[model samples]
Target: MRLILLGPPGCGKGTQAKLLSRRLDLEHIGTGDLLRAAIRNTTPVGARARPFVDTGNLVPDDLVNELVAERFQRTDRPSRFVMDGYPRTLAQAHAFEQVLAQWKLPVESVILMNVSDAEITRRVTGRWSCPTPNCKATYHVENNPPRVAGVCDECGGRLIQRADDNVDTVRARLKVYHNDTSGLIPYYRQRGLLSEVEGSGSIEQIYASILGILQPQGG
Candidate 1:
């Protein structure tokens, strides 16, 4: 089913998106990956998008909206896609609504992974990343450590703390998430499309919680 998985950074949106995509047979679309792929493929849009992305800011609305438009237009497209990181702001959400209406599609669900600020800080600040450019596989110092200490199991790359994964930055992100996303909750709820599931359990349990919310009405 078409879904928007919302959460603060490190609230497990990516993991839940993967699970939901597999179970529901929907494409898992992440905005960061979309921009990076566009840049890698050297689309004209990518050339224009690089500077905005390099600064860790949101991509310009025109560029990102066009990309999402392109994505939703592909043939053999599933009826549903789980978007992990698009439509992050009110502008993007408004743009997305226009695009979806033009395409005669409506979002099926807006899913939020509810987590407390303290838990977010605990999970995010403990993350370590592989040094390889664009390889974002993360390890937690306690929950999901590497086979060997301070080394990536996949590529043997050195693991470093992301510049934005520090306590201060994560706290700032949570503040923004709460402040910005609070309104969207009411926006989606009015449409009868919002479903929030606790995301702090085991992966399977969290996935099941989301799946129960998303199952088709009669299926």
Candidate 2:
């Protein structure tokens, strides 16, 4: 079940990835977590990524590509995995292709979660998170609000909306996402491995759709 999940910010890629990984018994490889672990372990790649990460700048495509390569090249590398938040651009996708070829771990499917920009804005802007270092619980205004408004039930910490989750920032992120994926989506489609799933439905509904695609009538 080697797979890649792609979507704009706030489209629930992470949620879907977790669900699919659990149900399919596949390791979930998320780039953000990958970078964080690399940096925490102070690996050579982490050292190079720290500056950009510290400054809130996007890591170079080559460096991110290397991170993915490093993981796949490991002797105990994941044999079945779901990749999320990776190969974000065409260049990264090509780099990943080379790594997959070298490792003989061709991806079976690439699922693109499609949601409107307006829906993304509403989704992101409605999120609030507990800022306590130990209790970083998140909540969505409509989907899962706290018992008391603006208060964390577990820690009683005042919930704060991350700057990146603001409407303007989310819109900007969607724009960048569209630009990067413009070619990436087509590349996968041409390879006959792309599957588009509507991302506006409930999490279970979306997960069911993905399962249906992965496990068709006789597949």
Candidate 3:
């Protein structure tokens, strides 16, 4: 059940990926998570990626490809996985194809979660989180505010919005998404591997929609 999730930053790709991975017993390979882990651990790739990350710039295709390639080379490489936030560009798509070919674990579907730009902006900009190392609880301004205003319900810490979650940054990220997916979406569609899912609904509703797409007929 190798899958690829394609969507803008605030389209709930991460949430859906987590749900699908658990339900299908597949590895959840999120490039964002991997990059964060690398950066936190100060690995070679992390060091190289930090400058770009700090500036809210997209990491180069070669660096991202190298990082993903290393993941695929691990002894416990994931044979069944759901990828989120990866293969963002045509170059990445091509490189990923080669890697999957090497592993013989071709993607069965590419889910493109669609959300409007305005909605994306709203969703991202409303997000706030606890910065405490032990409890990084997240909340949305409208949808899931903490019990007390500007406070973490779990840790009683002041909530902080990520720097990249600002409106301007989100708009920039969306532009990048549009540019990359202009090529990526077509690449998958032409291969008969693309599935479109609306990302505006509740998490469960969206998850159900995806399950309907992936499940065998009459299963």
Q: Model 2 over residues 1-219: C-alpha lDDT tens digits?
A: 899999998898999999989988999998889999889988788889999999999988899999888888778889899999888999999999899999889999999999999999988899999999999999989989999999998999999988788877887899999999999999999999999999999999999999989999725
Ten residues in sequence with the least summed lDDT for candidate 1: 70-79
| Colliding residue pairs in candidate 2 | none
TM-score of each: 0.81, 0.90, 0.84
- Candidate 3 — what's its lDDT? 0.90
If both were scored by TM-score, which would come out higher, candidate 2 or candidate 3? Answer: 2
Candidate with top lDDT is: 2
Between prediction 1 and prediction 2, which has the larger TM-score? Answer: 2
List the global CA lDDT of all models. Answer: 0.82, 0.91, 0.90
Q: Give the clashing residue pairs of candidate 3, or none.
A: none
- Candidate that would win on TM-score: 2
Candidate 1, number of clashes: 0
lDDT value, candidate 1, whole model: 0.82
**What is candidate 3's lDDT per residue for 1-219, written digit by digit as tens?**
999999888898888999989999989987878789778988788889899999999887898987788778778889999998888898899999999899898989999999999999999999999999999999999999999999999989999998888989999989989998899999999999999999899999999999999995725
